[model samples]
Target chain A: MEINGVTIEDTFAEAFKMWGSRLIITAATEQWAMTTAQAATGFGTSIIGCGCEAGIGRVLGVDQTPDGRPGVEVLFFTTSKKSIAPVLLVRVGQCIMTAPTSACFNGLAAEKTVAVGGKLRYFGDGFQSSKLIDGRRFWRVPVMDGEFVIEEEFGMQKSVGGGNFLILAESQTAALEASEQAVAAMRQVPDIIMPFPGGIVRSGSKTSSIYKGMTASTNTAYCPTIRQQVESVLPEGVNSVMEIVIDGLTEGAIAEAMRYGIAAACQPGVVRISAGNYGGTLGQFQFHLKQIMA
Target chain B: MGSQLNSEKTTAVSINDDGVTLRLKAPITLPVEAESICPDCFVGCQQSEILALPVFCGRRRKMLGDIFSVSGEASDRITVEGDLTHFKRIGQGMSRGRLTLRGDGGMHIGAYMKGGEICVEGNTRDWTGAHMTGGMIRIRGNAGHFTGAAYPGEIRGVNRGTIIVHGDVGNETGARMRRGLIVVEGHTGECTGAGMIAGSVFVFGKLGARAGAGNKRGSIVALGETAPMLPTYQYQCRAQFGFLGVYLRQIRKWGIAVSDDLLKGSFRRFSGDVTALNKGEILIHD
Candidate 1:
């Protein structure tokens, strides 16, 4: 399937079921909200090593937030239920709590709620008070500046991870530009996030590595693009290949993001567009390149 | 709230109301010895969580099957269908599920609600939703003193959740509420939002004295009033806060009738309680 002279690899991206939570962080200003969300989602690229994958889902308008403040929606995914609590405590505590005039809330309200504020409220050292409004609980912990409000518990639900695509361009600049545009487009869509440092993943790993005690192998197929020639080679005229990874509340959202991302990558000097699929993890539904175009 | 039952010899049956009463007909005798029982103790009689409750009843801290027969499903819902005039702690520290009282209930319909909904079809006594973290409460009829207010030693009333009363309430409505929205369709007693750090109280009817004393950022909407409010408040002219409209509309869908005047009314913003904390402000109707 060729789209605008760019080959859409007849392959699929492999993904796995993950436990996910959406964290809504509100701050005094848009900048603080974005900064806190970005920082919280940073370094979370792949669950392979980072233990989680996350991204900023959207830049929320003040009117849409619970506190009438600018906010950002962040999506974080982990392999297990137990793995989720630590990520929440560390990320929310360090990033959001550190940010000025910021408050955090759980985006998902599900059957079972986990304790986020219950764990973090101790930062106030018995100075925290809780309020239940509309059947949801919120805790107000006294902070140095004023007070930090967070939901007493967060809802957790099943999510998907590792929905990814590669951006292939003639020059590194073009690849970077296309990747940036694609990320911007995906950011507009809700319930999905790109957890990489900057929504761009330069390192694409195989299921496992050849090295001892290693679990991930580099995708040598898209090298040169990297340096030093290896067994697999990059297509000619392909100066760079950057991957866009996605983690969302649902598989449909991740698939939707890939559609937009691949379309955005089909610009000048682009050689091909493909996905890192795990042979046929997608069941019952497949997002075809031709279908996406139509 | 009253329900007819045929069970006899049901030991330690407790009806949480004005009195934690346990009564047995002369035909049946309860077996539990020592009293001062937790509600959980009654469940052990049949090893079930269903405890019959009324608004007010006679009790023996050291008593057995004080009032009525206890029977049926020990489900998440605990329903009482009697003349619960003296019910106390109708729902004490209920961590989950629904608790419904068919008739008027006495003090503390829901003291500490962690989750779920509690509906009082009839009027209720005081201290409702005290220190609650989650869930909702709707009192179809009037309520007595401290509806959604704090206990004496405590400084705040309801910690979280929403409380909607269809009728009038006694003194200290939502006293020291840290957060949450309390809507009273009828008149409210004095000291509403007293020492409140944050939260909102909407009284469609008249509000008595000192509605917002020491409030940090909470709002009290008196659609009809005798605003003998504290002098600490410096009135900041009337202006409509859009959230009030949204909130009123939300309650409307939930079956709480909040008059149109409240949604479209101009509110007087009083930024004070500076005596205790400068952060608090009282948003009152102009």
Candidate 2:
């Protein structure tokens, strides 16, 4: 099916089950909070290379934050539950803990909690103190500036990842602009993160590698370099393709974001819009492009 | 001093024993009525004057047999001494009962207890005296978090009650505590008196961070330094303040020995937690 001259590829995006956590960080000032949150979530674009995916969810005003200070919410997702703890320990220790006058809390209060601060509390040596407020536990580690308060644990939940859509354009510049608008529209969603390089992945992957041991294969359908040898699925004149992968706690949240992103990416300079699917060979969650668009 | 109830309606109880086990007769259930009697009525309950006494644990839907084991004597006051770590909703909504305990007691020590008293000689657990509209509790040792706080997910705490803790307390001490007085002779834990619309807490020892972090009204007199003073708090001038002595003296009734320097010393008044509504104040006295 096609609309607005952009062919809708009857393909799907294969994703795996991911575990994630959300941390609410606050600092003495809005800038520090934003910087610390951004840093902790930085360098995290995909579980393939970064071991995890993280990002700043939003900037909280003093009136809206837990400690009544300017704060930011961060989302982190991993391929496995076991992998999540280590990545979080290192991230929080190096980023949020090092930031001046910052405090962290579990943004997702799940039935089962994952110990984030509880594991990081050792950084306090022997001076760390803990308190129970409203049934939730929080730890205060003494710092040079004053103190760093963080929740003992953050909530954990199963999520979906690699929920993506690719934008095909005549030029690299056009592909980037469409991807940018799509990313902006996806920002309205919660409990999800765009874990692609610059929120856009130009190199999409296939299920298996031709040379055993390498799990991911290259995308031949949209590969302009292999247009002559392969039965290229790209419409004539298509030169570039960029994908946007999403990780989220719930399927609906990801679907909502995908819809907004596709609508934005379908703007000018975009030749076609399609998803990278594994022929329903992966997890149960599937995003039918037409159904979502409709 | 966690007490369970069994056939409380017909049971004869009087306590003057050195050691007795009043295990909560019920697990995961409301505390027995024996917990509701006044500190004074406890004398009658212990005196075997159950017929003449106007006291019991309180009113609940279950039977006393559902919660406790009463194998001790009938007397004027009973000493309950044992491991009471998991007890909860005890002495709730009590008005009068003279109960003595050598061990810790659980939440809601005297919930809405209008005219009674409960004395705990050891550490008391969280939610102690929570949402207590009235009554008095004298704790000889440290108390866990949320002492005199509102019920879980509730809006206000301890509309009126007198809670004296000889030892330190946890976060949100007297949280949302409205009209009442809480005196802590020892150090107080973090966020003491947070989100309190009214009330007062006089801490004699070192206090934890964010004391009175979100108070619309009430007074928190700090005798020692608390690290991590809330950024919301603004530093005011330091000067001699006699009111500090009065509060210290009031807690002296709880066996907290104090010197005169605290009451007659210079204090620093900083108003804040400006982060919220910016109404809380910390009076740091030297």
Candidate 3:
């Protein structure tokens, strides 16, 4: 299949089940909220190094927030439910709790809960107080600016992670440009986050590595420079490749994001749009490119 | 108090009269514990079974049928049309279903109720909603003292749920409440929210003297004129609280009155009672 003159590869994007939570960070102004959100999600592009993968879900208007301020919704994903609290404790305590005039609230409601402000309240050194409003509990921690209000707990839900699509182009610049456009398009969709720098990952990996001590390594077949030396999957004219990794609260959200990202990546000079998967192994979810495109 | 009931109605209980039909065949000469006459207990009872339920009239164990004339089949929704000023412990421990009281209610109305809802169209005696764990109690008329207050010797009052009083309430409203909300639309008697541990009390009318005297971590929001505060409460800065906007929007959905000024105005924050936990706050609208 082809869209916008770009060929659609007959591959599927493999996604694994993950534990995730959404947080709404509000501040005295939009700038502060965005700053705090960016800080909290920074260095959180991949769980391989960063304890979690996160990205800005959306920018919320005053009416959409609990605190009646300009806010940003962020989605955080971890490999397991047990890891969500520790990851959030570090992210929120260091980033949002330190930002000026910022407050945090749970963006989603689920049966399973993880401590967010409950564990961070100790920063108050026995001075923290809690308030219950409309059946939701909030912790007020004293800070230099007065008090930082954060919700006591956040709801965690079963999520999908590692939903990705590859943009294979005739040149590195063309691949980068198409990936950038795809990222920008995916950002407009809600409940999904591309947890990579500019939502583009150049170092897409395979399931296993040939090297003795490594679990995962680069996809050499897709590497433009090594394509001649190794088994190359790229069509004849394709020279460069980039991938957009997505983590979302639901399968539908990831599917929707993949659809939009692939459509946007099918631009001029782009040779094909493919996805990374291990022949339906090592992952529970599969998003077939043709089905999503159709 | 939580009262659970089956979702499907096996019976239907309704008041047979149009006005305040006296459910009781004769006026009670003594105070009776009418706790059994609630939606939780009558949801699946037949008229004969409802009358056969037990009640205590001043230490005398009497069958409910001997006192009141019940005719409707039992269901989840119960309506009592009568001068229930002699009835006590009505809707107590109710976890589900709806109970409607058409006339005056006696003391301990909805005490320890955990779920469901109680709507009282007439005045109620003291100790309304005492020790209630969940559910909602909406009193359309005046309430006697200790509305939503803790029972005697109990450490907490209403732990969860909401209580809305559209008319005046007597002394110590929300006293010792640990959680949940109490909103009084009219004047509240002296020492309102006294000894409160945590929770919120929103009084839209005149607040009585020494409000929130011994509060620990609760919020006493006085939208109207209030009496003098205790010396233990230290005056803090005035600011517009965003939580009030969220709270007002929620209570408005329940048909509670909210003025525009109260929703948009700044409040003078007073942190107290310093002699106690010193975490409670009194937010007087400025």
What DockQ do the predictions score, one after another? 0.10, 0.05, 0.37
The regions of model 1 sitting more than 4 angstroms off are A207-218, A225-228, A277-294, B1-181, B185-187, B190-286
Instruction: Candidate 2: list runs displaced more than 4 Å.
Output: A1-3, A210-213, B1-286
For model 1, what is the error of residue B158's alpha carbon versus the real structure, in angstroms, after optimal superposition?
9.8
Clashes of 3: 12
Looking at model 3, residue A276 earns an lDDT score of: 89
* Model 2, TM vs. native: 0.60
Model 1 chain B: weakest 10-residue lDDT segment is B1-10
The lDDT per prediction is 0.70, 0.72, 0.87
Summarize candidate 2's per-residue lDDT along A71-111 as a digit string, tens digits.
89889998888888898899999988898777887888777
lDDT of 3 by residue, B1-286 (tens): 1133323324444532221112667766589998876776776666676677788999999988888776565565677777889889988888777888988889999998888899999999999999998889999999999999997788878898899999999999999999989999899999999899998999988989989989998899999998888899999888766567667767777798776677678899999999789989999998
Candidate 3 at residue B164, lDDT? Answer: 92
lDDT of 1 at A30: 95
Q: B45-66, model 1: which lDDT tens digit per residue?
A: 3323324332222333322234
Ranking of candidates on TM-score, top first: 3, 1, 2
Error of 1 at B255 (Å): 8.5
